[model samples]
Target: MKDAAKLFAYFFAVVIGGALLAPPLFWTAPHFSAFFAKFDFESFFHRALLICALAFLWPLLRSLRLRSFRDLQLDENRHALRDVVAGILLATVPLFVATIALIGTRIFLLKNAVPWNALGAVLAAAIVVP
Candidate 1:
């Protein structure tokens, strides 16, 4: 990879890492010792995805800047076949699993009450992993 590409990759890795790990501050409880607050589901996931998009897009844009669209031909084929196979398999299998999980979650939530799918866990996993 070119230096610029490598730099962008590093940048992308960092921001994504931060987004994956970091959570913003929350309002504290005024009555119950100031450790809990009234933050809702919307605040949590919205902030989380906002953070992730910021973190991810920062580096992705950096990557775009590293090379103009006209000159982005990165094909390192010497040892890429194995890695390519692994990547494809990983992406495909998880997509299938996620599809099934989404279906099951929908049915279960319809019958009872659940919240896992609302987090976009399956989507994040599918996109990030792929």
Candidate 2:
């Protein structure tokens, strides 16, 4: 029960800390670079919040005595690459199917011009952000 309470406190701290930090980061990021200015502020805010949460996570894990993957009950796997590929497929195949269905039904329309330059960045973010 004591550990549970501490866990809850840590969780709240990370969430609230991230929420508080994200706005300032979001506001300041655009001034640092023209590239940052191009994306939506909301997207930037979310990514900033993610970074802040990750920053808080280290302390939480340390406090919980979780210093390694095995401590967290994630033992090393030999088929790591295969598992990753399978996981990605499991996640994306359904989304792709649904997207194709939506387009087929005319609920979603394909853009006439694709932003080729942004595609790699968008894909990288999609893979990394989650």
Candidate 3:
């Protein structure tokens, strides 16, 4: 029970702390660099939140006594990249197919021209944010 509570507290701190930190980071990023100003709010916010969450990662690992990937049972495997690619495909292929079907069936219409320039960033954020 104590371990579970500790785990829950860690998660709560990371998630809530990230949420609390994101707004200030989002607002101040442009001041630190012009590049940050160019990104739309949603993109910037997602990145900021990810950054904030990652800030807690080292501490979390330390608290769990995980000194290395092997300690966490995540030692590198030769199949790691392949497995990640397969997992991404497994998750996205169905969603892509369903989206295409919806568009074909006129259930979901593309109302605006695709913003090709922003597509990469948007895709990156979609993959990384969650």
Candidate 4:
């Protein structure tokens, strides 16, 4: 049950974050083609993606009772910045690329209808690769 909850949280975060970020990308693509690189969608997409990735900690949270949290110990040398950045890059790149690719393929190839989100391909790759 705990593991299931963790996975559920992860999925929810990823899906929600991706969904929310999609609009800005699509919306701004045309108006700022020349300066698309300088766009400020990061605030939205980065937050969403980080939320999604951080959802992985749900299982760790579930592992502890309220008592565990109370009794938690910390390693003095532990640093979250490196780990967080790495996770963000990993999660962001794959998801953003996969989503964009899938969306593009579906939109351009399938008669301009986004009938199937690119998540299927992303899911398949995620499953197959690992």
RMSD of each: 10.5, 4.6, 5.6, 15.6
Q: Write one digit per residue (lDDT tens) for candidate 1, span 16-69.
A: 654554343233322543323444544544455555666576566565564454
Tens-digit lDDT track for model 4 on 1-130? 5766766766786778666765666466547444344445644465446555666455556554434644567565477888889989998999979878988887534365764778686675444222
As a TM-score, model 4 comes out at 0.29
Which stretches of model 3 miss by more than 4 angstroms? 26-48, 74-89, 108-130
Whichever of 2 and 3 has more lDDT, that candidate is: 2
Which residue segments of model 4 deviate by more than 4 Å? 1-70, 107-130
TM-score of 2: 0.59
What's model 3's lDDT at 115? 79
Pairing residues by index, what is the TM-score of model 3?
Answer: 0.52
Range of the 10 consecutive residues with the lowest summed lDDT in candidate 1: 27-36
Quote the lDDT for 55 in model 1.
59
As a whole number from 0 to 100, the lDDT of residue 56 in candidate 2 is 77
lDDT of 4 at 25: 60
Model 4: clashing residue pairs? none
* Residue lDDT tens for model 2, 1-130: 4678878987787667777776776678668765566566567656766776778778777888889877878657999999999999999999999999999999999999999999998886585333
Question: Once superposed on the true structure, which residue ranges of model 1 sit more than 4 Å away at CA?
Answer: 1-36, 66-130
Give the top-scoring candidate (lDDT).
2
lDDT of 3 by residue, 1-130 (tens): 3667767877787667767767787788778766566666666556656775678777777777888777867656889899999999999999999999999999989868877899897785566443
TM-score for candidate 1 = 0.26
